[model samples]
Target chain A: MTALAIGIIIGCCALGAGIAMIAGIGPGIGEGYAVGKACEAIGRQPEAKGAVTSTMIMGCAIAETTGIYALVIAILLIFVAPGRFVDILTKAVRQIP
Target chain B: MQNSIQSRNPDRTTAKKPNKFVDFLLVLMMILPFAGCIALKVLFGNPGKGINVTGAQIYFTVKMPLQDMYITEGTAVSAAVVIALFALVLLLTRGLRRDPDTKRQLVAEFIVEKCDAFVEDNMGRGFLGFSPFVAAVMALSAFSSLSSLLGLYPPTSDISIVAGWAVVSFSLITFYKLRGGAWNYFRGFFEPIPLFAPMNVISELSTPVSMAFRHYGNVLSGYVVSTLVAAGLSSVSAALLRMLPGAIASFPLLRIGIPAVLSIYFDVFSGIMQAFIFAVLTILNVKNGFPEEEYERRMRKKQARRLEREGKKRPEREKNAA
Candidate 1:
């Protein structure tokens, strides 16, 4: 029974990690749009290629912050949160009257 | 060495042989560690049995008696930081050359000049005072992140270290803002409407948190992913080798090539990119806190006063402007 409970906790955490990774979609679309525009701008003025590329990279990196945050949360859930969570659950169950 | 060899091997076939030999040596160097590990596993019998998957292997922790506090990877990281700083100081102070004749002097001059130009371009000329601090932070961040390549846990992977850096940057930002005018700085928080003050305050507070997390998250994620990939590779190799005879069954032969490719991206590219971005953001934030035009105007006033003190006649245009 304890093994099943621990497995369920980890399974749920894995599900949460999968959910968290969905945030990557936003950055993917946003960066794609920005890169497309940047390419068009660079083509219009070849002399501005360096500036356009650097700006695009900077903008994309900033836009990637949300995705990175989600990744950090997912990592925490998968690697760090599970053990502490199981400990808490076990302690609470033991304290029941 | 290569030039001398090339000169001796003027024939096309001879030159091609040397090139091939060098390529072979490079490949051998790359694969040497994996080969050694496999050999050890075969001789020692299933070394992977001793591998610990959890906190035991990944983290190095020491307990402090005073508060029972756990000091983790910070111990290794702080030692690396101290060594790096000592080297930096030695490099800067040891050479007193009027003209850079040696390679070391040339490299030192290039670094100093580039750092100065980077600071001046971003923060303006009069604010070059901040260049040393910016250079130190950039060096620290870059070296700390790249330290992972040496198999040491990177300092930036710890959130607290990045937070400390962010706090220093935030304090500098606040100091510069206050220098502009304390009353204006306070009033600016409630600008355009009083209702927006709380939002303003929250945004101001979040600056340091975001900065800290941006770097810490990037480095830590890279470190975690690489470790996971390595473990996964080792397990896959172990399983595949199980099909062999008992002596070689436990050897993890396949754990060689893939992790090296991943490390190039995670350790090298991301580490350098994050360091550059951190420095860029620091310069931009500090530059924003103080107005360049105001600084330039003050400098002009000071120059005018100096000229007057010397009893030098101000130019006609300068007199009219003053």
Candidate 2:
């Protein structure tokens, strides 16, 4: 029974990690769109390449915030959640039986 | 490695080798750790427990004997902070000359000039006082994050340290906003409708949360990945050498070159980039917190000064219209 509970906890954490990483798509699309516009602007004004690149980098970093948050959540689920989950599960199981 | 090899070859051809004893001592110091580990393993029975590497393994935790308290990431961070402060003081205390004669003086001047320009660019010249704080944050973050490369746990990897920095920046933002005007700063939250106030408050709160998490997550992730890679490599090599007798099976030959290449990106590039982003975000948030009217007044004053410098008289008609 303990083994089954542990398996369930690990499986749920793996699923949560996968779901969390789905947030990566938003940043991927947003950053790609931003870079595309930046490229167009640079093409239009070659002399302003430095300004365009700096703005693009700043914008890209801000856009990456969501993706970074998702990554943090995923990392936590993978590395930290299982230990806490086991502790909680064991306590609950002891009370139930 | 190439530079060391070249220097060694030249020294061997020379009649007099300088600091040969010191060089031997350095090599011995480097080897002492592996030698000790081997000696401990030989003395004790092998439990056959493979290296149990995990995120927690990267951190060095020291527990106090009498209390439940423990010191972890603060150790590395405080050491980095002290070293940075000492270096800064040492650099500044060297006699100030019109012309910087030594390399250290030149580097110090370069850093000061660059930090001044960065602060001015982001927060405007009126907020030049913030340059020192910004410079310190950037220096501390970069140095602490990069310290992980030296096998010390980086302080930025600790969420609490990053959160402390973020909260300090948030407090500065709030202080500036209150200085601008308390009534309007509070009223700004309820703008458009009362329903949006909670949303505004949440957005305001998330600024620090996001800032803290971003730095912590990046550093910690890099540390975890590199550690896992090292552990994986060692385990793979160990498994391959299992056929060999006893001690030879445990040798980790594959753990050298590959991780160094990964560290260049994870440790060096990410460390510098995260430090820069943290400073830039701090400047942006602080500058954004100032009242719009004050900002406009400063802009107008600057424009008037610029026009005056060009030998143009202020138009009486425009002043009357204002």
Best-matching candidate per lDDT: 2
Q: What lDDT tens digits, residue by residue, belong to model 2 across residues B199-313?
A: 9999999999999988888887788788889889998888899999988888897897888888998899888889999999998988898886865665677788888899999
Residue B249 accuracy (lDDT) in model 2: 86
How many clashes show up per model?
0, 0
For model 1, name the residue pairs that clash: none
Every prediction's TM-score for the first chain? 0.94, 0.95
lDDT of 1 by residue, B99-127 (tens): 33446556666777798898998877878
lDDT of 2 at B20: 44
Chain A TM-score for predicted structure 2: 0.95
Q: Show where candidate 1 strays beyond 4 Å.
A: A1-4, B1-69, B291-322
Worst 10 residues of 2 chain B by lDDT: B52-61
Residue B305 accuracy (lDDT) in model 2: 80
Indicate the residue-level lDDT of B35 in model 2.
Answer: 44
